[model samples]
Target: MLVSVKELHQQTNLGDVHKEKPKKFDHLILGPAAGEGLPDRLQCQGIKALNKIHFGMSRNNSRSIDPVAFVTVFTIYNSTVESRPVDLVTVGNISYNKVKRSLAILNVFINFIQVNMPQSKVIILTDPASELPLQKDMVTIKPIQGEYSRDKLMLQRIRSYIAFLETRLEKLSQKQEQFTHFIFTDSDIAVIDDLGQIFIDYPNFDLALTFRNNKEQPLNSGFIAVRGTAEGIQRGKAFLQEVLKVYSSKFMKASRMLGDQLALAWVVRSNPNFNVRRFSRREAFLDKIGGASVLFLPCSSYNWTPPEGAGQFHGMPLDVKVVHFKGSRKRLMLESWNFFSSSSDLSDTLCLILKSGRTKYDF
Candidate 1:
């Protein structure tokens, strides 16, 4: 059966929210991405719990709820300063647009969990008053600081933001006196099926992160799970700082491209007790799975797969769990609409057109 991206998402569902007491330490926390319409399933408290597990200082010491089973979706946005967008859209604004589409994908994930995982909850962590429209299961908290650049300097800023949030969450932990785990997933991810197997199988690694082989390399930073530790948090902070130092100045001058993802790749590569897994195209694209609990995911259709394969990776029109329309490079151009319309339509007409040799799918 020819599966479109949206259909794959709808199919993966958990029977119902397990009434049998929720499991402990299966919570998720995601940095909220910019968007208006978000799905009820974007709840990834499980992913956030994984992040807390990897980055939080101590489970007992943290002021978070325990035995939480859910996902936390984090929004990782880059700045326009780092990437000089040739496309006329404002980099920040484009980020919001990208988040909108990504939110659609997250809804697909929510649907998957309802049918497949059933026991997971998804949550959002971000500014409470931001423009994005939020639904139930989403908690909006005030950021410690005001608006900051979403650029190369963004890594440092985000780390600080994370640290600040952790500190606040720690206070809450103290008040409630509960130990908890957290997982942080960016908005650009789609959960395909029951990925609980990964977390259940691998318990040694402090964190699990996804890596790409190269540009055609699968999803880099598509998903990561970190243990809450001083060392782990320190590593995340230090690595992000160093990466920002390089990219904020000379690195940008050299590559003229800002990749916070590369920084994450570096840290994961250098860390001990950190399991870095790379997902193959088949696993990444065809499988349609990713989350904070996922230690590794390949760059594929679900997260930031190029519309026509313009970036390093050339993806086939396989069933995509989520399509992350990365705003960094406006590869999907809207100008001359009809000319490119053939590429996006899910009908056989486009496929037939490509078959006729008028245009190749090898964009």
Candidate 2:
């Protein structure tokens, strides 16, 4: 029952859908479409807008993907127009600027992954009805009805994350034949290298999450690589459920504006015994976590965060692997996007920008 965007539009005829078949996209690191029965719930809440801008062009059109890939990457996208309502300050004559910025970032992020990680299949589970042509080895699924109320946007986001984990795990359980491991990341990510090793690196660990600023901020749930295991599967479900409990508690509600990070921190604290390991390139994590002698990754390249409490235009690091551009720094998002967009040398797009040869373009 897993169909491409065209199939869903033709069959359901849901909200403002384009009946015309989407042009095949040209992807960076090419692979075939995933034929496994991955369900996409097409609400079609916001496809009309995505089409007008031609947000993500047919970047991967020149390439083809192999369906029987071993690695799968999962990410989610829920916009204000499609998922919830937010009042963002926009400058100049641009309308829906935040939404536009998000779409732009997603385009770059997907292309980066495709260019770097050629062997992986990426599935973007979004509630918005988007028409970004499928990047080679990429599929967009409308997993479940996203929370639409603006009364409590933060709470709604928490609910969406909970449902996201539930649906993805269930679908992955059914389609076990298509993948060996899965990496879940946020849409704001701009990856700079091939992440094929991330899937198989820690076979015993159930989940491998990225972190930053060990002394100030303990962790970030932005990028999580989870091993699909039936035995400890229940624990994963329970962890998400517990996150809801913590997020909905009196303390959380009483706080000004609670976010997913707080809930993730709660999960990490509550499940210290769980087989969850940290991945970051910097030595700070090792220094903070009692210098665990185990061979840990310098994940700074992937989960790079800008310096906090700094003045505007703090700029990105020279060796940052993935510039996250966190939510609080929405203003910096467009800047980060611009820096990568015009820079002529994306690591994956051209074979000329090979990992060993390209000069590090720092912000």
Candidate 3:
């Protein structure tokens, strides 16, 4: 029952073919934030429309330096489910403390992009008017509004995941002209280093994503990058279509947790010619799975989590570029913001490791 790369991607040419010329985005870094901190479970209330507000960015507002075109996609879905905790908002109303802390964390990453990555323009994608105070300079807001069925998928907020997949990919396949590539990531993480170099170094890869669950059939859907070439966009669009086509089938339901993430994994792993890009360094291949052939970038560098304790990086195993902040919400939140907000960003982080003589810090 082994499936080779050929069989995996053999039928990629068998999907709906959209016109191959439309405006698409380049260097788009997007994510899902439909309902991150909202208290009420808005069950498909105001679906079918998106209320948008573009701040400081119009077609004619020219800036001295054109920044990197990075985007953050957020959603306030119509489902009554909260897949993750609300770290930035409180129950029933927005909390000032929560807002301050979360915005600080966001600023750390955004501030870094502005300072270190001067040319990389950052776009903030979120649900229409969540009232969260976001950084203004070198930032653009793209609000997504959509009505989705809540009863499907048990209570997971992955409807936005599927929606984003179909909407974005379809647009790209239509020759959506704008950006060159797209990176989909989670909101609760901070970037301490520049990841744009990865795409630049390996331009042939149609898709680049992180691995999880022991490199199984599904790549971590939250963190993915898609090249915007004709073939690249086509593969991406087809994969997304297949995901929606069989979303309610027996296989997805039986798994009990295969959202768009698993669907994407199936497509990429099945296709042999997708031209996936992995980390160039050897360290990334340390935990390769037999069948999941990807440029397995080292977790330590791409998505690093604490080994033990909450938010304490005393003994980090690798040179991390991003701290995913998966555990201990408050601690990670505070620490991540402080990490970049203060003068001690990446340089200081590395120096501490060298100074500690590779011994894990005891803080």
TM-score of each: 0.45, 0.53, 0.54
- Model 2 TM-score? 0.53
lDDT of 1 by residue, 1-363 (tens): 123324433533444545654222111111222111223111122112111101122223322222223334334343223433332232112332444433444454444334334445555544323334446343333343334344423343344435643563566556653332344555433343334444334543434444454543233443444444444333433433554554444344423233555554443444454433433233431111111222454343234343322122232233323333243212121111222233432222212211221111111
Specify the highest-lDDT model's number.
3
What TM-score, to 2 decimals, does candidate 1 have? 0.45
Error in Å for residue 71 of model 1: 6.6
Cα RMSD for candidate 1?
17.0
lDDT values for all models: 0.35, 0.42, 0.43
Q: Which structure among the candidates has the greatest TM-score?
A: 3
Better of 1 and 2 by lDDT: 2
Q: How many backbone overlaps does candidate 1 show?
A: 75
Per-residue error for 99 in candidate 1, Å, reads 8.8
Instruction: Encode model 2's per-residue lDDT on 184-243: one tens digit a residue.
Output: 576666565444444334444445555544533345656655455543233445654665
> Measured by C-alpha RMSD in angstroms, how accurate is candidate 2?
17.2
Which residue segments of model 1 deviate by more than 4 Å?
A: 1-116, 138-157, 168-180, 215-219, 228-257, 266-363
